[model samples]
Target: MKKNIYSLLKGKFLTSNGASQNWVMIFYLLTLAIVTIGSSHSADQKVHEIAKLNNEVKELRSIMIDGRGQLMKLKKESYLEKKMGEKGIAISEIPPHKIKVKSQKE
Candidate 1:
């Protein structure tokens, strides 16, 4: 047991006659490590992409809210009256009368 441990510590197993198995295991572990690193990088990129999209969504939502606010202000009766007055269009002093049309039966 002690001789086996000494041989392992001294890197003798890599040079011995049965070292092909050790080399295969080393290659397998290296491949697994590379795959693990690649998967982690892909996950990190997706997380960053989600964060960027979230920020863009928030910005667009705020812009939409701001546009709605401006539209509401523009649609106000007071604002329309002022603009129309500036354009020399005066409001009617008389109340509007709705005429009801009766359909003729044949």
Candidate 2:
């Protein structure tokens, strides 16, 4: 056991005879490490994308609220009256009158 540990520490496992199994295990570990690193990078990219989308959603929501407030102000009766006054248009001061007609039958 001590000899095996010493050989492993001295990096002699790959150069010694009957080292084919050791080489296969090294390749498997390397493949696993590469896959782990790639997955971590992919996860990081997804997190960044989600954060960007969240920021965009917040900005769009604020813009929509601002537009809605402006629309509400423009649609108000007082605001419309003021704008029309600037165009020399005025509301009628007199009340409207209705007419009734009677029909005669022979």
Candidate 3:
């Protein structure tokens, strides 16, 4: 009977309003809230930076894609053959291309 009463008393003490379980739960909630706020702040900044880089990549791709046809035309063998024929070593009819640029109007 004494042991039974002592067990009951111990149960009441450990399960009262000031129980260790309640304090531990409160601390866990507080820590979760703090970590959530910290991760949100860092993730928000990273998202903004990723969006900026994506926009920059889009702009550069637009610039690079602008002259696809002209680039293909310049890279053709026909243009190279024509240029080589013009600067042919067989005949000296045409004037040699000079690096110095003289104004056409002057």
Point to the candidate with the largest lDDT.
1
**Cα lDDT, model 2, residue 100:** 70
Which residue runs of candidate 3 sit more than 4 Å off their true CA positions? 1-22, 67-70, 73-106
- For all candidates in order, the CA lDDT equals 0.97, 0.95, 0.85
Candidate 2 ranges with C-alpha deviation above 4 Å: 1-4, 94-106
Choose 1 or 3, whichever is better by TM-score.
1
lDDT of 3 by residue, 2-103 (tens): 987996677764577778986698789999999999999999999999999999999988888877877988899888777778887343568988698899
TM-score, structure 3 vs. true: 0.45
Q: Residue 32 error for model 3, in Å? A: 0.5
lDDT of 2 by residue, 4-88 (tens): 8998899898888978999999999999999999999999999999999999999999999999999999999999999999999
Q: Taking the candidates one at a time, how many backbone clashes does each contain?
A: 0, 0, 0
Overall local distance difference test of candidate 2: 0.95
TM-score for every candidate vs. truth?
Answer: 0.84, 0.82, 0.45
The best candidate in terms of TM-score:
1
